[model samples]
Target: MLGARAWLGRVLLLPRAGEETRMAQSPAPIPCQPTTCSSSMGHKDWMDKCVCLLTAFSEHMRRVPVALPEMVHAFSAQQQTLKQIVICGDRQAKDTKALVRCVHSVYIPNKVLILADGDPLSFLSCQLPFLSTLRRLEDQATAYVCENQACSMPITDPCELRKLLHP
Candidate 1:
């Protein structure tokens, strides 16, 4: 990542051939168009902010930018419940990635994915305590769709998970 950052003012990805990627003149922090955290906050703080923004933007449908940013805070507290999907399996396995891809395809904005690969990182369960109890059902990749921390039955089929998320 640092290697990429080193080339900051030197290169940019253009949408079309021979197009100008940036302005001739700009303020400090020359390349601010795309940034992870442009403030004094450290990496973890920036990551948490990114996750929060992702959660907020996921709520808007095909379009919402036409409205003011205030729409995000306008929602009632009760309606802001987060939906967590915990996947317990070998995260490196091809099948596990496929399941995660399917989850990413869903339009539901409040959803978040947590991968709990078991023992070596069992301490992870301390952060998300439910991971301590949930395991691979039937010895296969399993997904638990939980809302407000209460989950529906363990899901082993991608289609079943889709139905639960969308319909």
Candidate 2:
């Protein structure tokens, strides 16, 4: 299990321009360490779970508005370079996990707002008003990639998500 310092250090090492400023202005990183899961789970599984938890925690930390203006200034400085990739998927679906792992592997959280929820349509509609028309499109798991507010066709295959994110 990685310590908070180690996880924060790794996040800091990423090539985000004003990330340091944002981190300074935001609340401290979550102090919790990754706890071991079931013994049957592989190391990769444990690590993935840890990463997801940390990502969620970091997102929560960013909600503080104490230094909103400064944070916005810092974020705007890098806005042109960062692509706001909003990924939406059903949180309970197996394919949603796959899509999340794919996005995390390729894009930095600083560059993308990856939003995954069991009710993605409701979640995204509230977060991104432009996606009010977006829907799950069936019971099966699906993913939608919206770059800078322009959404692509809903994707049902994880491989297609990888291609869309990387390409």
Candidate 3:
């Protein structure tokens, strides 16, 4: 069996309908750059594609077991304080993804995101009192930024959400 990265290289080189003929005529490159798949490509059977990908990955993992890699970030924060962002709203709301991305960009160290549908805060807040007030503002997707149980006012706009995470 090939190593995970090499196997992935070959799998990625699989040609699409139109490219099949051209790809077969020439050899694939020795090195392949990683690529991201967009959901907008109009492939209707994404779930099936996901299943196939997962199955292949699982088979590879069963044989190799584990792969260790060390990563270093020079600009990473040295602080230990946890910055938690709690978002409560419709999970499928388009803006929800943007809100999550905003949280990721600002905090590099010790960050946690708690995503919930509606207000499940009554029970959860008992343990983390800071989240007691987390809820969707105006029935729209809302974000709350908290540190050490102290939280900011609900943010309804993407720009406002990013500012809260940065400041």
Over 53-130, each residue of candidate 2 has an lDDT whose tens digit, in order, gives 444554554667543443343334233333444445566567667767777778543354555454535654554455
RMSD (Å) per prediction? 10.3, 14.9, 13.7
Better by lDDT, candidate 3 or 1: 1
Judged by whole-model lDDT over C-alpha atoms, candidate 3 comes out at 0.50
Per-residue lDDT of model 3, residues 107-133, tens digit only: 445466877664544555554544555
**Candidate 2 — which residues are off by over 4 angstroms?**
1-82, 108-110, 116-124
TM-score result, candidate 1: 0.54
By lDDT, the best candidate is 1
TM-score of each: 0.54, 0.45, 0.46
Order the candidates by lDDT, highest first: 1, 3, 2
lDDT string, candidate 1, 31-128, tens digits: 22112221211234433443454455454422544322323332322245557788888988776776788799898755568888976457667655
Q: Which residue pairs collide, candidate 2?
A: 91-117, 91-118
List runs of model 3 lying over 4 Å from the truth. 1-79, 119-132
For residue 70, what is the lDDT in candidate 3? 6
